[model samples]
Target chain A: MPLRLACQAMGTRFELVLAGQSEDQLRAVGELALEEIQIAHGRWNAFANDSVLSHLARCAGGPPVTLDPETFDLLQTCVRVAKQSRGFFNPLLGPLLHKLGLRDETKLDPAEDLGTLLDVRGLVLDPKGHSAQLTRPGMQLDLGAIAKGAALDLAARVLVDEGVTCALLHGGTSTALALDPPPGKDAWQVVIGPEKHAPRAHLAHSALSVSAANSRRGSLPRGDHSHILDPHRSRGTRHLQAAAVVAPSAATADAWSTALVAGCLPSDPPQGLGLLTQTTSDSWLLAPGRPSCFHIEPCTTTTPPLTAAPF
Target chain B: MHDNHSSPDRRTVLMAGAGGAATQILPDFLAARPHLGADLRVGLVGVGRQGRAILAELGKFDEVTLVAYCDTDERRLGSAARRAKGAKGYATQDAMLAAHPNLDALLIATPTHLHRAPCEGGLAAAKHIYCESPLAHSIEDCRAITAAAASAGKVFQTGYQGRANPVYKLARSFVRSGAIRDVLSMSAQSNQKNSWRTPASDPVRDKALNWRLDPEVTLGLAGELGAQQFDVLHWFTSKYPVRVEASGGILAWHDGREVADTVQARLTYKDGSQLSWNATLGNTYNGTQEILMGTMGTVRLAWSHGWLFKESDAPTQGWEVYANRQQFHNDEGITLIADATKLASQGKLKKGVGLPHPGLYYGLETFFQSITQEKDVVCSAEEGLRATAIAIKVQTALTTGQAQDISEADLASK
Candidate 1:
């Protein structure tokens, strides 16, 4: 029997489905996973003054501040992904987002130029010393695109370490991590957008993340102003309708999904990754090795809407 | 000291006494005079599930001694006795009271229907009483127990643990301090997915164990769970509800249970402020929380956590630097209320897997402190009766398909 628990964490709904354990044991493990997610939120949240991200943003261009191992590793991952995407996935765009009134209030240095402040290369990390410094005068870090995914990944690791074999973890219904499949089943069956005519993916030991820019705007006239911004262009991207990525980790899938939809990276994802892109005219799916793993039904007249993201 | 020579039948004497101001002044006057005791001897009735928890909390105080344990279930009585070490076990409250006549206080954790007898008995024995909430199953019983506690001149604490929770206290202070401005309305919810029945080894005990499923014995969701939340509303607004309209049904778990699994109620106060409360056993979406909306801001409170959402034009309280760290629904998280700063300073908060059950622990500590210091209890019998009256009225409104008005005359009626 499978047990499911739902809780609110990281400003979104999180669901944990576990098998091969009693309800009591599953509940205990679920609580542990939620606690871990809260700790991650406390560390990586850009809005909180007590968070390490805020601390780094405030102390930019000053003495280096030593960070905890968890935060240091997260910063390292953010820098690595930003470099991999050619500054398209930069975390130093917090000031720009704040100026646009897209996020909570943030303090930015008044004297520094916007270009220097939004430069991702200005962040200096020393892994050995467990410390980081913002080399520029006005740099700020925002992990809005990747923190939820990272929290989900950490929660999944908690379940696995607790001896849970078949489990599925989701953060806000957009980012999901599937552990080993249920007994006698090939994989965890997940339905992507459009319930009636949508594509269904069989996920086995993988993670899926979806990014939709127009989800929040509904039928408003300002729907064209996308929330997903291209850090390289320093503006919102409105070309793509939706994008989904399947990778070994939720953080990777989250980053790529944002990158693909923002037009920072090409629609054709790198090798060993699955991509699903939806545009105004048509939708496409590209699976490198197992192309037939997903089954998509023909579009019906009343196509169901895609799952909305909380970005 | 209480005048024990007045009458053994305190209920009769109290019913005949003046109803106006004496009843209000007597408890306060008696509470001001110390009982002159260094050690407190306590007796517990109904040492079952919730009883065991109270017993453990009581054991934490060195000045408090568990003198007797009483329960109808022999197995539970024996277990409680073992936990209390030197405490004696009995099969009835009468037996325990007779054996321990000098008990300073009696903590009653019995079921709703069984509360009146032990509470009145403890009062007649000149013992301070601490009774669990939803004071009794009927309005008459609640009136009788409260009247007895009043005339007996003994400390009577009701277990609405929210009154003892620091987070709730802090949130209440924030709302009342004019930080949130004129209160407009409030809403509360408690959602949980559970069977609400404990397993039993015997067939007969199985039905008895799940007494909450019986409509006659239980007050259903409103009485059992909503009592604490209603108390919180009163504490925050300083006003009892004037009228209540409610609706409920057994929406799920159609397993021959008469009580409703889901309930929604709205209460109207004299000041035109309204409060809405809903509870369901079928879903656990947001778990449990209470939200208070005002002219300037809003306060969302849970048992273990709380957050304040201020309006954009409202004046900043200088705590935004701390609150802005966590965000939910565009609201900043207020860390001062929920975090363990006090416990950390006292070296009591631990970095570990489990959190402390602060509500019950602090509630029990308050009960003991009232006994030792001759002070008024945080949740007195008057507070308990008012909240219970509202909850009972809500239940009545649900069943009668009409709104019910709460009156002081009805609360004071025997």
Candidate 2:
């Protein structure tokens, strides 16, 4: 039998043996999900256009974000993650990230050699709706840093509640979320890597992945571009070919691992992540002393670089 | 050695060729597909009557291999021994065992009374078995056979051939799929009025011929025809019959027979599914020619003139019908679903539309296949116990005036 949706208080996407009332309920849930995505997308793009946050010394006017309730909820989550990462994973990077070609507004034209120096403290959030005024314009707010992972964790929770016990949700394949316990099998597993879209890559273990070749890279349908703009170089994150992050969720692993490489953390692995990056010799090297905050482990399995499906 | 990670396989003899003739059915069965992946091979016990016919029938399959053949009658054993190919023939079953040490399955078709011994022998040899039903001489004997199979980890599939009829399979499929909604109850008839056999002259032939009348050996009337009918009914309704009410008496026979000429039974299952059936082998004209009824549909899987009834008006003054054996096979005949479809094709598509043809031989096939795979067969010892328990009660019902309650533990010693 195929996986059936477990309709519960969380949501409704039940797969029935006999097509009964369940068909209509799932369609409604799908609609709600799409609307949520549009709202989140609009909010992120609005932050990119606001000029106040970046020009802190030059201007005093900025735009306020106006999106639906879900988007509002998403921004609130950003405030939470920013607080958790201690501003190190700042969502208020609108000014500095934009200057480095990271904002969704401008068609990014990358300059060579971007590296860390992006200031995290310059960003701020207003507790009220549509009212957080950036000190000046050109301050691009990029929630791209952690919102994708945060949303995945949230959506997985909701989807599981809605009777979707087993699913592979790709919020853009670079970030994937799998929420299934390995019932009648070895263990719950997933695959993460660049070129994950290639037929060759398959999950045999629990995994998560991210790469610099996202859509920001070039003219490919879905290539991982260096979305992480090194504030020092005023350009996209560079060098160290592709990074393969294996954690429980692609959203968190992919986003944070990208942050790690873009910030120019030392060649020796940091304590908080399971980092595997391609070396000049083409072999992948891993980081040391993992962070106790999340579950991540050294992986020996092969994976292709992640690419987007033909939209 | 005690440390374990996998589920324990509690096996029962599923299908072991009793002697050599099982070879007849397999070659034709496996001939079309030379491989069963890794299924068990079958052996036949007796090469007389049913065993002889089965030997030739199995000859049509390539998947069948002759293992060993047994017969108390040395004359028949020698002839069958020559025809059985590489399989060895023994005057007694013990000699055959000394030869095929690796033998995995046995099919017992000697006689209704002789079914238990070979079953016990096969069990001791660690072989899965598919035995002809009634299963044994007494409700007690059948119980003993079932217990031995359970203890030896051998699968036992009682030969209840009519359960293999695709119409019953079709009806079960429909009901399980909930096409008919919660079933209120069900009723079945097996009025197979006499004319089942011919008269015999020789005393020994007469003894075999009048198996129904012989109190000395024959399981009597209920065992002869009632056994097949009850087993099929038990399988069609997943519930073992909780009680049976029956009345039968001997009205006529060619020679003042002790066996009843007419017998009928009414069975009530746990869910209150009522089943009524009659077997009067003396009369042939009254035959409905293979009929089945269900909540969602009704079907006839007879060899000729089959019919399927779906949510509709009552069957006509005469039954709705399809001609030809094509009703049993599909356009390709490669699988069972297509074969059932050819019968069910006329009706609207419903859930569980196709019947489960675990097969008359397919069950036997599964028996041996499980032995080969070292897995247990589908039919459990308890199922054999359940069917036998109902049969004894039905026999008692035919004679005595009350209903009997048989529990799982009651069947254990039985």
Candidate 3:
């Protein structure tokens, strides 16, 4: 029997399913994985006054703040994704999010000028020193987009390190990672959307992350204002309804998917990642980059999908 | 300590014990003494869960530089080093001390049984030391660490966090100033719902990692969790327990572990006031807190929040009108605001209800203050030993199903 466990962290419920010979051992390792996710949440939750992210925000414009290896890597990944997505996936849009009244329940009018504080370059990261410094104060690094995926990635690593090969971990069902195929199954089938005709992504030792503009909305004047912000325009993105990405790393998939839906990246997806996007008109755009562990299959009675040119 | 039986002026008493003088807009909020002293370089020993938490809090201080971390477990050391930015990794405290002679201080978060080596080594290197609470598992090791710290002529602090917390400090003043009147009894509990087993791929490493479950060296729940809470009562009352009677069993998580998952201990002080403490790993109801029941009222202290309940017949204070009160069944608790006067004046008393940070942050701040400002250590080694001695007695009593006598000799460093 597979052992199932769940924990609430990062403002979402993270669940894990593991298949192993010993139930006791699996539970122990599974609990440890959950602990890792909680640790990640405590370290990076942007709203938490005591989180490392808040500390970094406070220390901005001062000396470079040393970060733990994991956080340092996450920040590096954020910068890389920001550059790859042409600033659509900027992590420094924390203040803008606050202005748009998307950070918490407290509502505030969205700011008109958005580009000044969204510059990813202002985040000076020292690889040799293993430190990061914000050139200006009030510059916040919001990991809302990629933090869940990073936590899932870490949890999956724990499961793998504990020699548990068959495990499925998901953060709020939006970001998921598969350690290995379950017994007698080729891959883990993950439905991308809640629709009856939604496509299924067969994940084998890979990750899947989905981002939708309509998933979360703020109390803005515009009824369709989403939590996903475009750093350049300093407003919510409405270019695409939803976007999903499949990659070897959950954080990578998460970043790329957010970028795709925000309409930040080019029409063609990255080389190693698979992309599925929904247009505002409700049409599906498929960009299966390379033959990898991630494969997509349409649901029964699902219409034909539009395919992008090979990268 | 001031008399506890007298009815002092409410605003005067609250302001005097509110950590600092009320010159700022929000006295309690600004109770955080700014680190105005010179910057200090520090290293951490035992890069485990607690060590990582310390790293996060230490990062908040601008004057402190995390220089290195030492852990026998290379995986934890490497992981912790990455989080600490440029902090070098060492396999041993000696290696870290030798590599960074300029390291001004060392924060020890190792297992209770493994504390002596790091404490002694840091002391030998003439470095300021901050060891996590319940100083050690055994009475002898606690004495040794205390004696070494005394001879080192360096700043030594134990991680009994309550003594340094602003809320606790504020609450302590109220208790000492006779706000609660003569204390009749005290009780504390710490509940966390998880199996106390750490995961490791290797069996040998797993055994080493789960030291809290090791009956020989481990102090079980009473020592590991109860000692910290017990220290709060000791600090508030400025008294010691003369004897302890405890009973516990493996009521939960009987997965081939000898350590009890639930424990109940009653400690009797010289004045015959008893402190009942319960620690459980199987349940997390009500979380963790310490309660002081007095003739006049009761004071409840959670790590982040605190409250004082006044008897209906007790003398009412002028500040009671402005204080925030929370209802608990039939009882009502007046929220113990550290700088109630300053906040009350601004009509922001509600915002100053709880601490901005955890108790650990304040303890680290105090340690840094002691190092740079030449201030007194908040929770010294001797106090840590006394707390540890009480915990040791509790553990012995629970294990043997008998009452254990705690003498002054058990807590004395000499």
Candidate 4:
């Protein structure tokens, strides 16, 4: 049986289940994983004054600020996804989010045009120098959707490096990554959504990320807006109740799920991706090279419970 | 590869000799102290730069009382005493110990040459001792102090603050847990553009303050700066060095100083694990850090931050998805074990500003706790002696231009 350990990190609960390791070894790996998550949280947190993202935001429209290789690569991925999804995965939406009163502090003027500020195209990256600069004055980077995924990826890396072959790592139950399975097991069995309404999927060496409109409670008094803002619409999008994507990486899955939920991409995603989206009419699964399947299920819950099979 | 010849019995005898005086005084000391309460009265020896820093940290603890400040320099003592307010000032360590009979502990931050006297004296007085690193300037003093501390039966902690650092603690845990697999070798470097000289109005006092430049009173870069790094290697490997080969010269700051501003040394353990270290005072290119290599992975650690780099044949670490795509040329490791700047940004500020230098607060806190709770210190006298012996041997190798074998007999001789 796998030993499960849970701890709070990245503003959410993270769980790690490991098999084929002693209790002491499991605890050590768990602690290291949690610490890595915490480190990622500190580095990428947009609201933190001393975070790398905040520093980049502050240095916008100025000289390029040097970043560590890990952060530089993460930003490079963000830029790639933003271009691929036609500005849907824009990290430079901090001003728009702040203007909508979603973020803690408003560093931008409400009267200012957010279209110019949300332009991810203006962000310049020096690959050789390992530095980045935002060409626009009001542009700010927010890695909210991707940082947790990156942190999950880091946790998985730490576990695997520690000689753990079979492990299930998750960030706030929304993004889950499965390492290699146990000695005799084919894959880690994972159930998506609620018990009666969810579909069971076997995962191995892959990650799954879920983004739902109701995942974050609306902070507005009228309950009209969500935490996930649409960069193109310059507002919150709730057209889809939920969207889930399975990819080789949690970071990729996380960004794609957010893009799908924002209605920026079609229901049919790119190749090598398994997608599931829930709408008012019906729930659909869009697997690569497979026909879309429809089902009737209630998807009103903010957070769908996830279940992992025994190791 | 060096052979393992050191026996446990020799170590026991060395420890026994070190603790002899303290054990004899323990009963009377316990009898004399009727009530051991929350408060711990501590005397400060060598209230200079590092001493004052420790004093400020000690002031933060409510359970600590800075009862006395001792320094050969009256001016520094007076300045430290002013900050301490109610604490008494003494011109000499002997006077301070003589006056402060009720002091529960002595914090020795004296010069390298001066550590042995105060440390030995404090143990003789039945007071728990916390001495700054390197143990002493010379091997003889290191042996004498180690034996005295072992004999004392009181808590005797060496000032290797990395022992109390959280990052070091996590890294050590990772190594001890066998996560890094079989150890191969280690490399460490410390680069700085520092003269290591303090200004003084009096010529004699200038020489005294600038003890680091004088070979007679200094351990050079290997002992003075490399002691903590060497101690960390030993801590992670749980083994002492069997041989040390060193070479150095006064490559910079040629102001009549006899000590080398640049030095390099290689230490070999009985287990065949080797550690290579180098430090240069002329350049600040890659400011101080250590890297431990293992069969499975590599751990790169500085004072405030650390990262884990897995080997190519090791199991796939998932972070590589993010790390491998980065634009930078350097390797992006999997786990960021400790990053003080990031932690502080997240509002986890309990550990103080995580600079490259080892924070004195945690070490001092551990010292106070050991005193009141009767617990063992994180860095014990024996551990300090081991590191010191290796450091001294490195210096000897540099002087003789040959590799020196460090045997258990060397430790047990004194």
* Candidate maximizing DockQ: 3
Candidate 4 lDDT for residue B307: 62
In the range A11-65, model 4's lDDT, one tens digit per residue, is 7888888887666556656766776677677678876544567656755777676
The DockQ of each candidate is 0.02, 0.00, 0.29, 0.01
Candidate 1 residues lying further than 4 Å off, grouped into runs, are A1-311, B1-37, B201-204, B322-325, B338-357
Q: Candidate 1's residue-wise lDDT over B1-414, tens digit each?
A: 111112122122122222212322222111212233468999988886678667645533556778898998876776565456668999998898888888999999998878999999999999988899888877888888889988999889989887876667667767777767899999999888655654344668756666777777778788888988998878887878889999988886665567788999999988888999999888887878888998888888877656678788889644353232347765675443333332232222221001133357667767877888875588888778878888889888887889998887766635
Interface RMSD for model 1 amounts to 16.4
In order of lDDT, best first, we have 3, 4, 1, 2
The top-ranked prediction according to lDDT is 3
Against the true structure, candidate 3 has what lDDT?
A: 0.80
Per-residue lDDT of candidate 4, residues B231-260 (tens digit): 888787777789999998888766667788
Give the lowest summed-lDDT range of ten residues in model 4 chain B: B25-34
Model 3 clashes, total count: 6
Give candidate 4 misplaced runs (Cα > 4 Å). Answer: A1-311, B1-37, B316-328, B335-358
Global CA lDDT computed for model 2? 0.48
How many backbone overlaps does candidate 1 show? 1
Query: lDDT by residue for model 3 over A244-308, one digit each (tens)?
Result: 78888999988988888777754545687877776654566675345444344443322222121
Cα lDDT of model 2 by residue, B283-303, tens digit: 544353333455655444432
lDDT of 3 at B168: 86
Judged by DockQ cut-offs, the docking class of candidate 1 is incorrect
Q: List the residue pairs that clash in candidate 1.
A: A48-B325
